[model samples]
Target: MIEILRKRRSVRQFLDKEIEKEKIDILKEAVLRSPSSRGINPWEFIFVTDKELLEKLSKAKKHGSAFLKNAKLGVLVIADTRKSDVCIEDCSIAAITLQYVAESLGLGSCWAQIRLREHNDNISAEEYVRNLFVLPDYYLIECIIGIGYPKNKPQGHDYSTLQFEKIHTNGFKND
Candidate 1:
């Protein structure tokens, strides 16, 4: 797991190749296994492989989402707001689990945050997604994980660059 973490990097550029169905299934299982608060498992996923839809979804936000147009798959991470109080946290764990499984399978993934973003002046990103998918009002969009074969795999962040100072002892102490 540590090795996978060491090599994992957010990949925005992907090759024009479709992800294998077996790998997609594995990703499905991985997210289902993701830990949730009291096992309420409020998260849900929409595996999008349609080219036209992916293209449209790429415009979900003004920035940081254009690259999703080229992704072979877009996994919408949403949650039932009424199911759990920690819906965001549960969705986040599932999203990261999907990403890690993608990395382990020689696939690349990038996350596009949707919870608090704008698609345009008329609507929020979440609202645009809701309208696009015709989702119910009780569902909350957390993010979209764009997955595909990487066009170019960038190296992970160097260990020397890690912020070791962020780690604290038993209690929070000012420097």
Candidate 2:
């Protein structure tokens, strides 16, 4: 598990090769199995593999999302606040776990943030994605994870130094 965690990194470029169905299946299983608060599991995933649509999705944000155009698969992570008040937090954890699982499968993934952003002039990122994907208004877009065989491998963040400065024994003690 530690090895997988260390190996996982944001991969923005990909090859033209296609991902196998077995790999996709494993990703689905990992996503669905994610634990949620109160077991509400307020998350839902919309997968996009069409090249044309993926390209359009890459423009779902004004910036920081151009890589979706190269993603062999796009996992639009969303949550329905109607299902749980803590839907955002739940979806975030699921997204992280999903990426970790992807790394374990020898795939690379990059998460594009979209929760509080805009696509262009006046379209909110959530609205932009929702409109493009035709998703219901009840859903809130959390992020989009671009997955594929990396065109190049990115070295993971070196953890050897371990930022102990940020760690606290228990609670913050006022200096």
Candidate 3:
């Protein structure tokens, strides 16, 4: 699990290959198994492979979403805010779990932020994706994870770069 965590990176370049259903199934299972607050699992995923729609989604954010255009599939993570006040946090945990599962399966993924972003010339990024995907009014857009085989593999993170100074004991210590 630590290896998977160390190896995971924000993959932007992806090969134009279809992701295997078996691998996708694993990611779905991970999401379903994610721990949620008060057992209110607020996440609902939309697995998109449509080319035209992918193009539209590429415009969901003014920036950082262009990579979705090249991804073979994109997972739009939506949270039912009406169900829980902490639905965003719960769904975010599920998203990270899905990314870890993808890494374990040799797939690459990039997270495109949508919650507070806005399209270049259109409405809010969340509204754009919701309208395009026809999501319900109560479903709040969290993020989109663009997934596919990597066109170029990025090197794993070096442990030396970790910020250990951020960690503190029971009593806070400066310096």
Candidate 4:
């Protein structure tokens, strides 16, 4: 599990390949097993394979997410905020867990956050998604996770710069 966590990376470039049903099932199982905040489990998932809708979302959220175009599957993790104060947390945990699970199954995944600012305005991207999918008002689109086989492996990053940062604490070491 720890190895999966460490090996996971955001895969942006995906091959034009469809994911297997069995693998998809495993990914969904991870979501079902995710721990919900306060046991509210205020979350739902929309498995998107519609090419037209995927194209629309890719364009609508083009600013932050252009990688959706190549993804074979997009899982929208929605949260019922009215049901729990930690709905965002619940949804976020589910999203991250899904990413790791997908990677464990040899599938690549990337998380796309739905901007609240866009939703606040009637023209928000969230509004576009809600209208497209006919989602109820009670549900909020937390994120869209793009999944598929990778076209290229993720580039490695050197965390040496972060080693001397003021981020960690050892008995409150002063600068």
lDDT of candidate 3 at residue 122, scale 0 to 100: 57
lDDT per residue as tens, model 2, 1-175: 9999777779999989899999999999999999999999999998889999999889988789999999999998999889999998899988998899889888899999989888878778889898887888999999999999999998877888667777788788655
User: Which consecutive 10 residues in model 1 have the weakest lDDT in total?
Assistant: 166-175
lDDT of 1 by residue, 1-175 (tens): 9999999999999998989999999999999999999999998999999999999899999998898999999999999999999999999999999999999999999999999999999899999999999999899999999999999999998999999889998988778
| Model 3: CA > 4 A from native | none
What is the alpha-carbon lDDT of model 3 when measured against the actual structure?
0.88
Candidate 1 steric clashes: 0
Candidate 3 on 1-175: residue-level lDDT in tens? 9999889888989987888888888888988999999998888889888988888888888689999999988888898888899988998998898888898999999999999898756589998888897888889999999988999988887999989899997878988
C-alpha TM-score for every candidate:
0.98, 0.95, 0.95, 0.88
Q: State candidate 4's TM-score.
A: 0.88
Q: In model 4, which regions exceed 4 Å deviation? A: 117-122, 159-167, 170-175
The numbered model that scores best in lDDT is: 1
lDDT of 3 at 15: 89
lDDT of 1 at 15: 97
Global CA lDDT of candidate 1, please? 0.96
Worst 10 residues of 3 by lDDT: 115-124
Model 1 Cα displacement at 41 (Å)? Answer: 1.0
